[model samples]
Target: MPEPDPNVRLSNAEREALIARLQTATEEGRLDLHEFAERSREVYEARTYADVERLLTDLPAEDRALAVPRAPAASGDMVLEPSYTHLKRQGAWIVPGLIRVNPKYSRVTLDFRTAEFTTREVEIAVNLEYAGLKVILPKGAHAIDDGVILEGGQVINRAFTPGGGQRIRLTGRVLYSRLKVRYERRFLWWRW
Candidate 1:
């Protein structure tokens, strides 16, 4: 296959796809955290194909599979209603750009270990009344919790890092409920 025009301007979706590939490379140990961070910043700032391509020149070609396009979900929002049931989102599901968790008298758990993110940044909005929400993220995932509003509830965050890997922004209100954010290493045997 002929190589794409390096000078061609990249679209938003194309930039996001490249970022996803970089994230996968980081997770696969093909690139270190520092390299991933540097490349990610370059990806976002890249205006042409060559700018983005230069960042991935050292990465293996297999990482291109991570950029394959997928069908969009019916709804990007995840809602939990008033019930005693527990809602969990894990595995190879696509991580939406915006996730809404509004549960009354229920528990919601969102695990982003193996989830595929189409964007470099993900925003999760939580609004719980008399419910509980626990978000589990991979170790390198960076979290921001400044937008959370707690009313008669407590939020325990163990995953708030300023400049980590993929960015996750948590925002919403919790009334008479509990919200916890924690992180776990992707591989138990490997430590970076």
Candidate 2:
């Protein structure tokens, strides 16, 4: 077979497959959590096949096969809904342009420390009912709370810093729930 084109853009399915492969590697003791997280972030942020292939250079051939080539989508949106259990998305996950979170009687946390943002601006639309939603952003990131229609609930924003870097706009409604947005401070031992 011919070598895959390095400059070819990746599709969502291809990226997800790579992520699953990495997770498998971690489960098989081939990679640790830190290494898997780092590689996973790289996979999501990768634009071309070459960018993704480099991440699997040290992995086994079976794992590398998951990084197949596919067409890229015009736009990407991620949706999350937790019914009873808590859901947390952290590490090196991909952060699309639009994110919709709807949780009922559960908790959802989104950490954007090692996340890859394809666009300069991100929009988060939340429809929470009797649940808790927390968003953690990196320092220097800007966020705007457009507005929220509440029915016996509160929206506490501690990450709204209008400066530079990337921008995140939050909008939606909360009914008998809590939405907290905070920033992650850089520590001495933490390396981004």
Candidate 3:
């Protein structure tokens, strides 16, 4: 099929389809909530066919209605999938905008105390089964766990409240697992 011209005007139906693709990517842990909102805004503001196509370049096409082909690989997502192992991320690490965690029979720790965040809002998509996941937020950072679905699981938050600071949103399913959100304890000369 011939590639659509970049300057071709976009129809309302095409715009809606692009937005739907963004929503699907968010649900699949490819895009965070903040990213979704931003891209949705772009979709509404988009005028040309290329404008809409740019938003979906990194996402796969699950439906044939779009007709346009996607790039072979999707970027900008960090996935952590482990089974029967222990994974820890701390210190000076770079936190991407989206993190997808799927762990089974494992223990995972994500400490954002000294890490660098590329965006003010981050989303952690967790799909857990028989696992233990601990997230240590930086001081003054807010966290929301409202989007998580628990099936014989727990989502515990020993962290900051919603206020003027960085925000982290957790989503996805937790089956027979435990997800804990807390802050790093600070001492006089060290952190715990």
Cα error, candidate 3, residue 87 (Å): 0.2
Q: Which one wins by TM-score: 2 or 3? A: 2
Q: Candidate 3 versus the native: TM-score?
A: 0.60
lDDT of 3 by residue, 124-159 (tens): 999999998999998889899999999999999887
lDDT of 2 at 3: 63
lDDT digits (tens) for residues 86-160 of candidate 2: 778887567789999999899999999778788899999999999999888887887888767788998888877
How accurate locally is residue 191 in candidate 2, as Cα lDDT from 0 to 100? 50
- Which wins on lDDT, candidate 2 or candidate 3? 2
- Candidate 1 wrong stretches, greater than 4 Å: 1-70, 185-192
**In order, what lDDT does every prediction score?**
0.75, 0.80, 0.79
Error of 2 at 106 (Å): 1.2
How good is model 1 by TM-score?
0.57
Q: Which candidate number maximizes TM-score?
A: 2
Candidates sorted on TM-score, descending: 2, 3, 1
Candidate 2, residue 159: Cα displacement in angstroms equals 1.4
Q: What tens digits encode model 1's per-residue C-alpha lDDT throughout 98-158?
A: 8888887889988888777877888888888999988888768878889999899998988
Candidate 1 lDDT score at position 75: 42
